[model samples]
Target: MSDLILLRHRQIPDLNQLDVYRQHGGFEAFQKAVTTMNPYAVTDEVKDSGLRGRGGAGFPTGLKWTFIDTENWPHYVVANADESEPGTFKDREIMEGNPFQFLEGVALAAYAIEAAEAYVYLRGEFWQIADQLDRQISELEAAGLLGDKLFDTDYSLRIYTHLGAGAYICGEETALLESMEGKLGQPRLRPPFPPSYGLYGKPTVVNNVETLTNVPLIITRGADWYNSIGTEKSTGPKIFSLSGRVNKPGNYELPLGTTFRELIFEHGGGIPDGRQVKAIMAAGASSSLIIANDEALDTPMDYESVPNVGAQLGSASIIVIDDSVSIDWVLRKTLHFFSHESCGKCTPCREGTFWMKHIIDRVHQGEAAWSDVELLNEVALQIKGKCLCALGEFAIEAVTSGIQRFEPDFRAKVSESSDEDELLVESEKA
Candidate 1:
């Protein structure tokens, strides 16, 4: 609604092409930053804009840029294009449609960090998108937009595209760096964060695709201009990948603070088949189920407000669930995904997700007692805060939240199983 910063290709034709992108004020920010502004100034502008990471964590983007270790030589930049989150397809669409802008954003970030090279680490499933981006990166280099000595200035940069082995854990910044370094895709220990030691053991700045994509716009327009679009805390427009029971399921770009009612009904055309909206997974499969009450629906979909509704606006991939579906079924599917995607890095995530999947399978099959449900909840709670990465924590979000918020679904499942068991016992006695 706010003039489509990331999805400009939705309005303009051929925006992915280098010439077409350049014609529409692309690379101007990179040019300005390289030719005139200092690297720190570009970072300061982004810091002032109040832009947070769109990659679930919602960490401050500009603040992250400032953390680059100045003492470390040959710093690096990596744009996380690993869009593996279930129900979140915004980054893939961004790469396929408005790629140059994303690349430009990557360039801006590289410049801000004074890095000579950058990598766009995409999921292996995004091969076609990676191919397109590869061509586009070549085009930028050919046009003197990328490569050494950019814009006739001393600043030099080169960006490359690396494909992950379809591992979701690689979406984690340190793991992504590890994967790029040709290691097993699992998360590294913290304290030496990516900013301090990353990518072959040097200081690095790793950003999400959507997060890096905002950098160009922030640099092009002043920080104040970009800051005015969204809420004070969650600035700029976010692309919500509305899916599931919605009548019209696709990406809807709107200001960060827009309410769920507005996105689902106003932009997403509401639920399908005249069914009542039952719940909202505000952050895709990794989200805690937000009960679709008036207060939850009216709640603003920002980093700060969404949590109050028992969910985080993690990736803002709003998966609507109508009354026609059961929350237990949703939980099963989400658990399966997380379990399969788990890299087996930590015992909690690896075994926890695996057992949770099996327990949810029994629950969904109507073969579990109420205690089984409680065990499921206990296992999920056990997984919290014990893993090396967010994957383990994310695995339990739907499990704990669904059991707590949608108790009826699980109760009906266990109740039906109990009734069947009693019938079997009576028949055996007879």
Candidate 2:
């Protein structure tokens, strides 16, 4: 009903400026949290708001804040700003357009968790954005909004920005922690989760950019008000990054329960040249291929409803595939990306992804027999449950789902003849 909260800068001019942002009530929520409400009370309000993480996990944001170890001294908060996933670029836009709001969200979270220091871990490619944020952080500190003894209170806070070496594996929390520590970027074994052991062996709260961007408003508006926007299970507005085949592809912020038809047709302006959509990759390159039909088009694009169509609403990066596209080519592109980005920490993922890439490449090149498709599918299943982190598992999503939802495409790409026939063709070419 109301205009955008995270993207309010679109309606107001000069919002990126600290003075202009202050004119629009910027940093007021952080001030209220630090001055009026206790830390735990702030956490409780977020829990009551029904806000979930927008970093593909969909975990409760407040619940994560509550997990911070109060016993630990000098807690840290890390904002995941590595927008490496294909078809996912909403975070970069927020940082570029409505920056102060996002920084304010980071500050609010620090107050709630009582973190003395916070860091924005950005990708190496975001050098310009990180530099801009550095200047902004300095502005906030100079304004007495980010430095020690804020608002005449004893609580002190500082925010910093760190850049990763453009590694997609660093997008994972533990991997990000490892990278921040100047080590290799790979995921750590769980059990001692980030809340207990993280970022230099101290309790840390690692949240995504969009997830934190919701904090300021949740604190300003009552939980009841935020909860009334979306469905009972999945509340609040969601920023859907629309890409691929649509005429007007970009970010469209809508309620969580909006349908695929609405996102692709109404917001995205439908497929270009009046082409029919054949499949939907609902969460960028990491999502399973959802058959685009009446049922899928009507399916609600919420965390709870997306799984009914065999995929999670991970980050809501919807990629629309037209009927003119082939599923084999899509899987080839996705597999190549995953294999290249894999950290090679685990055998199944490391080996399976390499093997899948070769098989898919051969199939794409029209040099492989039909059996290669079956072998590729089997290899993807083998790598599903046996990865060091999500990189490997995510690598196989398009492969398995592409094969399942569009078997004809895979079958048509490879030769129908036996392996001997393929070998003879290869020999003749040689």
Candidate 3:
């Protein structure tokens, strides 16, 4: 409770209402920015705050804002609301419970980049949430917080909501831009990145819903205050989506450097029915399987620290795997998800995911030999660096990591004997 920043609205009843939010000091930061501060000043404040993107990559937020090409006309801001990652639902909660705050963050970012229009791109599954956000945007317009020339300034901004057809690939920024523009939702090559060339081929600032939601607070409280809360590199509070096998599973908001042990045992109420946690998936299906030993459990859950445990804190979607749950089964389910979600834009992701899925299915059915396990591992390796986007790379994380770290689980499912036994049989046949 002491370190809570993002989820403080949980304590405030009816905070979703415009008047209630205003009463609780809602758009005051945006107001301050629009009326008094210059655009670069706002961007500089965010830069000084040391806030990193909360959406998986942990990219520096302010640095990203600075990357927007100022010479370009009609700059745009897009909030990446496609929370399609399994076991990750923090963005939905933020939008549902604290819609206005998130919108204000969007507005502040729009102001920073001097963008006239901003869009919140949501997955089709979030239809209701999108509707709610649309109403909130209308309310802001009626209240003079959104639409044309806010707070008697020359600056004007408008926010819109667009729904995707549930393509998980659209979560990638360039792909998201492509989908928004009525094109196929496949990733565009980088370095003509979103900053220099984005949405409609103009400079755009595309940030996560959770990332934009932090901006108002950074502006209001000052950069030093935000910086003081989290670890040196990974600053500010993060809402870790806790799911699977935990007693009380939900979003637990804490500072960046909080340990996995505290998140699981304390906030999550530990494993249900006294089952031992065999492994911890730090970032949903995309995470490398982390062995749930005391050493790993004690490791702090931050962008800097989680990597020490052989996994990235990607999106911080912590899915606990108790001993009762076999890692092979987890891999099977994860592979199936990636296979189904593959955009088919490139060969590695398109064909690689399909091939890996069949291999995983065979292994899961106990119909594969020990060599098939090697083949599965090899296929994942082949797909590792040859993809068009992070989805392809993420597709192999659980497969390779599961086989390497939890070999016993995969080995148990194979019909054949050990490699030595198979070699002996081959020699006898010869």
Best by TM-score: 2
The estimated TM-scores of all candidates read: 0.96, 0.97, 0.96
Model 1 worst lDDT run, 10 consecutive residues: 421-430
Model 2: how far residue 40 lies from native, Å: 0.4
| Sequence-dependent TM-score of model 3 | 0.96
**Candidate 2, residue 173: lDDT:** 93
Better of 1 and 2 by lDDT: 2
What tens digits encode model 2's per-residue C-alpha lDDT throughout 263-324? 99998989998799999998899999999999999999999999999998999999999999
- Put down candidate 1 lDDT per residue, 172-291, tens digits, no spaces: 888899999999998998979988899999999999999988889889889999999889999999999999999999999899999999999999998888899999999999999989
Candidate 2 residue spans exceeding 4 A from truth: 419-430
lDDT of each: 0.90, 0.91, 0.90
TM-score of 1: 0.96
Judged by lDDT against the true structure, how good is candidate 2? Answer: 0.91
User: Which is the winner by lDDT between candidate 2 and candidate 3?
Assistant: 2
Candidates in descending lDDT order: 2, 3, 1
lDDT of 1: 0.90
Off by over 4 Å in 3: 418-430
